[model samples]
Target: MVTKSSSGEPSSPLSHTDVASGTTGEVVDTTTAPPAQGTAGAEVQQTPLNIAELNAPDGNAPVEINDDDDSFDGDSAIGSDVGSDTTSLTSSVLHYKYENGRTYHAFREGQYIMPNDDKEQDRLDLVHHVWRLILRGELHRAPISKTVQRVLDIGTGTGIWAMEFADEFRSTTVIANDLSPIQPTWVPPNLQFETDDAEDEWLYTQPFDYIHIRNMGASIADWPKLVTRSLENLQPGGWIEIQEHAIEMHSEDGEVPRNTVQWLSEMEGAARTFGKDMNVAKNLGGYLRDAGFEDVHVDKYKIPLGAWARDKRMKEIGRFQQAYRATGLPHII
Candidate 1:
């Protein structure tokens, strides 16, 4: 029952929720009785899809991109070794300075790009596409209830998904929490953004019906703990969706280039040195199951590092990788 968007990208099959314009935002309490559990479905759908086209404005110029560099221009490569050499990285102090006096180990150049930037928008679109795809799986299903309406969007960069979900589901209240407040204050009635870390204890009193987490490969130090927290905060029969990418280079049917593998290995090693797990995708399903989630399922998709891949599906994934690499690598490396 998944529907394809205008660009032909497949979306979750959730019944189209009404998007009412004006209403006072209210949070829902989930301590009461929960909804009935539902059966999972197994379906494979292939719809014409283009991530770039979905984000492009009518006929705007293709997104401008460049390798990580140190100009103020947005078209700079990320994760490039612009500031320090690889040899010095082990000894050099790595930290990021955000506007709100928050700092963390700055692993790559992508860390510097704020959620409001064009590059961030591009990444967000891809993330949304992948998330919708994940939600299509049999393991996750949202509970439908007018009275039980609450959503928690973890690592909600730019708050785009939160805004879209609020606009789509006017009755549901969404708390879009992130490390920064890049989201606009003026937003959909039911959507609100807050600056918070997922690792810390959350203060929300209500268990949510839907908890969505994305792209925590760099910031999250403990996958099992995080998944447990997400489960603890969910109402019985509620759904949780996690979206992430593998940092280790992987190829299907012998399409990946050797240099790409080497590059990814180096990057993975760098992240490991800094106490971050680059292969979070591998253990996500197990983490969920260990956290007491039933019917746990995992689907793996390979993304090409370059256009050298032969499979059409792999090529499309490569396009996304190239786009992110072209704009985000400097910050990550």
Candidate 2:
């Protein structure tokens, strides 16, 4: 975990490794104090990240993520509209639209092309588990000390990450926002869900120590504005981390799968029709830098499509990825 002192200058680089990927270290920087209101953002200079072997062959058994742990003690709060001031929202918020035997959110209808039905929700949760396995049970890659305060989770579908984070960090207050109120009501006390949109102006009264965004590719319409809002609402020395997949798939031998390529091409074209970018991962670093983040870092991970990796961990991730893709494609289309 690399750090920056209160002077806004980077401190000595430190080594922090992830148990799953065995990443060499994380490159991070923080401004211990918030920038002055009238001050311009710092120059965008991103530090190079030191990455480790991502898909090396290993003999160890695959790490198992327990799905049972995600089960709540009470009855499942499925389809419940529980969020910040739920009563204030109009009935249209719950007036979902159905088409071609699938359900979509009514609050921001057609803004997001994906369905919010039970199957898609399950797939979302499955992908979340894969992410946990990818990071070896770690919630985020940012290097933050124990003195952290508030946290924000953007596009918190299913609210899985936010709930787990609130459970782990009981002291810190957590706020998660999403277009659909599909999050479960049986959640940690420290966490709250909000029915909000990321592309719109943020109206939070306080700054956050950390902000996390994941799997929002093809959903966000304006990346720069989102990053800028996040920057403005962050405390000095705070961190914002985005975890996304580069949409395009490739093979190690430089051979592309014909069918997969065709599918992704169509998906990309359709997303463009909606005025959204299907492939936003590769451009996130540039957006962050342009938003005035002084020290940005990029962590790249190679996720296999099937259980063909020689390493047990990679094989597990591939298997789950394959399942989610298979089940999710129809809903997304």
Candidate 2 Cα errors over 4 Å, as ranges:
1-89
Residue-level lDDT tens digits of model 1 in 192-281: 777666778878898777787767776677778878787777766766767566554322222233444355567678777777776576
In candidate 2, what are the lDDT values of residues 1-333, reduced to their tens digit? Answer: 111111121121110100111111111111112222332344432222223412222312232333232211112212323332244567888777898988888887888988887777877888787778777777777765455679999999889899989988989999999998778777899999888888888899987878898888788988888888888988655778888777664434323334444656777888888889877777888888877775566666555544445567765665666565556766664
Kindly give the stretch of ten consecutive residues in candidate 1 with the minimal lDDT sum.
15-24
Model 1 Cα shift for residue 160 (angstroms): 1.3
The global C-alpha lDDT for each of the candidates, from Candidate 1 onward, is 0.49, 0.63
> Could you give me the TM-score of model 1 versus the true structure?
0.60
Candidate 1 ranges with C-alpha deviation above 4 Å:
1-148, 252-259, 304-317
Candidate 2: deviation at residue 59, Å? Answer: 20
* Native-to-model Cα distance after best TM-score fit, residue 257 in candidate 1, in Å: 4.3
